[model samples]
Target: MRAAEIRLPGVAPVVVDREVPRAGDGEVVVEVVAAPVTPLDVLCAGGKSYFGVPRTPYVPGVQGVGTVDGRLVWFPTSAGMEPGDGSMAGAAVARRSDLVELPDGVDPVLVAAAGLSAVAAHMAMTWRGELVAGEQVVVLGAGGVVGQAAVQLARLAGARRVVAAARSAEARTRAAAAGADAVVALDTSDHMELVGRFLAACDGAADLVLDPLFGVPAAAAAHTLRAGGRMVTLGASAGRTCPLDAAVLYGRSLRLLGYTNKELTGAQQGEAVGVVAGAVARGELVVAHEVVELGEVTGAWERQEAGVVRGRVVLVP
Candidate 1:
C-alpha cells in the first residue's frame, strides 16, 4: 500500500510505500476510497500537533470513507487525544466501534465530504446543545463543513427557521441549499445594519445561535438571540477572545455552550454517528466532497489550509 504520511511536524506529506494495516480483534481493515483533507489535517501538517504528537512517520488523515470487507463504511481515524494513521492511503486499519456503515445509494465522495463534520455537527446540536424542534437558529460561519452540516441538521431536526451567515456568496448559496431560511453575507458594507437585517429576516431574535467564529461575530451573534436563547460555540475560526456584557446575558437569560466531539465518550460517538448516518440514509443531509487521486494530496492540503476551497476535498488512494 502507498500512504501519504507526515515525516515530522511542519513538513509536507510524502507518498511512501508501506504495508497495509491489519485489523485487530474488534477492528476492520478498510480500502480507502476517499479521504478528505480537513482543517485538522492541515493543522497537523503545520506542526501544531493534536491527537498526540504523531507517532512520527505516520499517516495524517483524521477521517475518510472506504470499503471494509466490501461494505461501504466511514469512521473517525483520530480517536482521542491521540491520532491514528488515517485514510490517506490505499488501505488502513480502524476499530470496528469507531466505524459507521455508509448508507446504501450514497456516493462515496459525498460520504467522504460529510465525514467527521456531520457527526460532530449532529452531536453538538442534539447532544451538547439540546436543540429542540420549532426553535429558530442563527448559524455563524455557515460556509464551512461543520457550519453547512449544522444548517441541514437544524432544518431536518425541524427548527422553525434557519438563518445562515457566510463570508461569501458561494457559501451563502451552499447554506441555502442545505435548507437555511435566510442567508446573510458577512462582507456586507454595513456591519451592524447587516446584523440587524439578519435578525429582522428571521422575524426577530433567534432562539439558538450556532457559532463557529468567535470575536466580533460571536458578540454580534449574542445580540441576535432572543430572550432565554442559547449560544453554542463549536469552533473559533475568528479571533478567540470574545467580549460580552455580563448584564446582557443575565437580562436575556442567555446560555453559552461549548461543544467538541473530542469531549465525547465512546458511547456518545456511536450515538452521534447514528443520528448523522440515519439522516444520510434518508437523504435529509448532503455533504459536498471532491475525490482527487492520491498524488494530489499535497495540493488538497494547501487548499484546505488556505481556506480557499469550497466543500471538502477527498483523496482517493
Candidate 2:
C-alpha cells in the first residue's frame, strides 16, 4: 500500500510505501476509493489548527468514501487523526459501527465531497443550533465545502430564507447554485452596512446565523439577527477571539453557540452521516466534487492550502 504522510508542518505530504494490514475484530478494512482534502486537513498539515497538533509522519485525512468487504461505505471519523493510518492510503481500517453504507445510487465522488462537511452541517444545524423552519439564516464564509453544505442543508432543513456571505463572484455563484436566497461579498469597507443589506433582503431581522468565520463576521451576524436569534460558530477561520459586546447580546436576548464534531457521541455521528447520506441519495442535497489522482495528493493539498481550489477536492486512491 502507498500512503501520504505529513512528515512535518509547513510542508507538503511525503509519499511512503507500506504494507496494508488486515482488519481486526469489529473492524473493517476499507479499500480507499475517494477522500476530500479539507481546510481542517490543511490546517492539520500546517500544525496550526485548534485541534492539537497531530504527530508528524502520520496520514492526514478526516473522512473518505470507500468499500468494505464488497459493500460501498464511507467513514466520517479519521482513523488517521487518531494515531492510526487514514484514507490517504490505498486501504485504511475503520470501526464497523463507524462505517456508513453509501446508497447504491450515490456517486463516490459526491460522497467524498460530502465527507465531513455534510455531517458537520447536519449536526450543527439540527442538534446544536436548534434550527427552526421558516426562519431566516445567514451563512458566513459560504463558499467552502462546509459553508456551501450549510447553505444547502439549511434550505433542506426548512429555513425560510438563506443568505450566503463570501468575497468572490465565483463563490457567490456557487452559493446561489447550492441554494442561497441572496449572496453578499464581505470585502467592502463597511461590513456593518453589508449585514444591514442582508437583513433588508430577508425582509427584517435574521433568525439564525450559521457562522464558520468568526471575529468580524460573527459580530456582523450578531447584529443582523432579530430579537432572541442564535448564531452557531463551528469554525473560527478569521481568528479565535473577537470583540463582543455584552450589552448587544443582552439587549437583543441573542445566543452564541459553538460546536465541533469531536464532542459528539458515536451515535450522534451515525445519525448525522445517515441523514446526509440519505439526502444525497435522494438528490435533495448536492455534493460538488473535483477529483484528483492519489499521486497528485500533495499538489491537491498545496492547492487547497493556498485556497486556489473551488468546491471539494477529492483524492482517488
Scored by lDDT, the top model is: 2
lDDT of 1 by residue, 27-138 (tens): 8888888888888787765655554455577787878788877888877676222556878999888888877777687777776777678877877777777889988888
Cα deviation in Å at residue 308, candidate 1? 1.4
TM-score for each predicted model, relative to the true structure: 0.92, 0.93
Which window of ten consecutive residues has the lowest lDDT sum in model 1? 75-84
Best by TM-score: 2
lDDT of 2 by residue, 1-317 (tens): 88888887768787788788578899888898888888778776676655556677777787888888788898854533556667788988778888878888787878788867878888888788899888888898888788888998999889988998887788777888888888877776365676576666665788888888887767766777888888889988776876566777999999889998889898888778878888788887775568888888888888888889878889887
Q: Indicate the TM-score of model 1.
A: 0.92
Relative to the true structure, how large is the alpha-carbon lDDT of every model?
A: 0.78, 0.80
Q: What residue pairs clash in candidate 1, if any at all?
A: 51-82, 51-83
Clashes (N, CA, C under 3 Å) per candidate: 2, 0
Candidate 1: count the clashes.
2
